[model samples]
Structures are given as C-alpha cells and as structure tokens.
Target: MSNGWNHTAKIESLSFECGFCNNKVASDIGFFNNNNIDGLRARIRICPHCSKPTFFLGSKKLPDISPGNDVKSVPEEVHALYQEARNCISISAYTASVLISRKLLMNIAVSQGAKENLRFIEYVDFLAENGFVPPNGRGWVDHIRKKGNEATHEISLMDRDDATELVTFSEMLLKFIFEFPASVPALPSA
Candidate 1:
C-alpha cells in the first residue's frame, strides 16, 4: 500500500471493486518498479485483494446513494446536495460525491443552528459539541473530513467505496440531525 522508495506517495489503503474479479475489497497498492522509474504516473500497480491473479484498474461505481430512498424526508437544501452526492457516486465520480457530501454535512450543521461562517472541519466539531451528532459519531465524520480533503486538494482519484461510506455516514448524520427528531414528539409538562 505504498509507492517504493524515491516515490512520494504513502498510499496507505484503497477500497474498490476489482474490475477483473468483480469483488469489493480494499486493494493494497504498490509501485511496480519497471525500468526503475521512481515516478507514480508509471508506477500504478494494482494488488488483487483476493489470492487470484487478477489486475484491476477499478470497478464500476455501485448505486450507493439514492435520492428517492436515502434522501427522502430529509430537509430540502440538504437533500438537494445529498442527492447530488449520491448521483456522483452512481456515476463513479467519487471526488465530486465527496465534495457534495461535505457540503451536505455543512448544510446539516447550519440547519441545526450551528454558527455560520465556520470551516467544514469546524462544523464537524460543532455538531459533536452541540450534541447533534453523538460523541462516537465523530470518528466516522472525521473520516469524511479526510476524504473531503483528498477530494478537494489532491489529484489522485478516490474509490467509489470510499465515497459510498461517506454518503452512508452522511445519511446517518442527517437522520440524527433531522428526520428522527421530527418524527418524535415533545414531552408534555408534568
């Protein structure tokens, strides 16, 4: 899961469906040192998560985000961006999906009365601090933060699975922030 020495990539982990085997798994990446070139452009080596000898660039995007099912009953502004994110995921545009999901989270924060003019990372913290998202949810939301950063700032592509995870997390977050609360009634005074 790393480019060889003289390469600048740390890689770490990449989750995707193998184009060859059509199985979803986190594929480990490593540089293929042919001609001893140290650049990543020529070093895109794919590892089969399965023991089978198959090379895959990546698999088609799964329909992970659904506007009709996933975003139904969600608030309007948030739902619009969330649907966009989901649409991106369906088309294998993980980068765009992530960016839209990030925006969705921001919209959720604002809808829930979080202060305006804060950065995206701050919104995550605000959600946790304000009890909009429980403490345990912070870690996964932070994962979205990382993915959002990569999607916005890096040239390297992200996997559909990664964006899917972010969308799923966003769906949960939206439910916690909006749908669940709306369905629940306020308690009467004793």
Candidate 2:
C-alpha cells in the first residue's frame, strides 16, 4: 500500500550530508521519536565520518541556521567570500564566520579603491574616512574588527550572536557599497 506521505514504515539507513563534517553519506538511524497523533517523526542520524549526531524533524534538520541577508549586484570575488562566511554559520563555525567577516572588510575596502597591504585597522579606517562605511555603522564595523582580532589572537571562540552580528553588518556594508550604488542608472554623459 502506498500512502501520500513520504514516510516509510521503518527507516534503517538514511542518506544525508553530515552537518559537522559536511559529508554526504548513508548512515544507520540511531533512533527515532514517533508521535502518533501528529504523525511527526524525529530521527537522530549518526555521521560515519565525524561520528556525530544530526537531529532531523521529519527530514527537516534542526538548528537550521539562518543563511543571512542576500544583496544583489555584488562582485564575483566579494560575493564568493560573503557566501563562504554565511555558509560557515550554517555549519556552526561561528569563529570562522567572524574571521571571514573581518577579511571581508579588507576586501570591501580594496574593491572600493583603498590601497593594498595596509594594516587591518587601516582598512577599517579607510572605509570610515572615505565615506564607504555607512553612517552609524562604524561601531559595528569596529565590533567585527575586535571580535575577529580576538578570534585570531586570543584563545576564545566566537558565539552565534557574535558571528550573526558581524555577518549581518557585512551584508549591510556590501549593500551600501556595491548593491545600492549599482542599483542606480548612470546618467548619460553630456
């Protein structure tokens, strides 16, 4: 008998990408929680590569990290780095995300005509001094710089809130510098 739903009577092995290891493989289902009234099934699947458990609520993964905001008309290289930072958050790599957010500041500055090989702080300053950083955005840009420096120099790990804030700020900065400017139609040369 075939039911309209995609649920199977019994699931032995499931194929999924391990969030921790980012590997696609089939692994044995460790256990399942079934709710008869709601027909909801929660499964814990073990990742063979990382030996970690991923929680799935009826095939929907838990801890579904937000993918961050999307800005159009971004340069290809900058877009790639921005996506990398965003993807790091999805894998719970908060520290990596924070670091990438910091690097993005440098990239943005250079893309906006700032000189290369400048000190990290200089990049932040260039953005602010040249009117690249949005008004009232210098604070959060500094936050990204400080947190990123701590992640690099100290023995501390970045939390979700820190990563989210930096990534969000980076998105806004990119929009301000790239997307928003590209959005306007260029005036015809006289």
lDDT by residue (tens digit), candidate 2, 1-190: 1322333234578888776666787987465555422576767676778878777766567434456677899888888889889878876788999999999999989988989999999999999999998889889889999999999999999987888888888888888998999899999999
Q: TM-scores across all candidates? A: 0.62, 0.70
Per-residue CA lDDT of candidate 1, range 143-174, in tens?
88888888889887888788888888888887
Question: What are the C-alpha RMSDs, in order, of all predicted structures?
Answer: 11.9, 9.3
Residues forming the 10-long window of minimal summed lDDT in candidate 1: 53-62
Instruction: Give stretches of model 2 more than 4 Å off.
Output: 1-63, 188-190
Task: Identify the leading candidate in terms of TM-score.
Answer: 2
What would you estimate as the lDDT of candidate 1?
0.68
TM-score of 2: 0.70
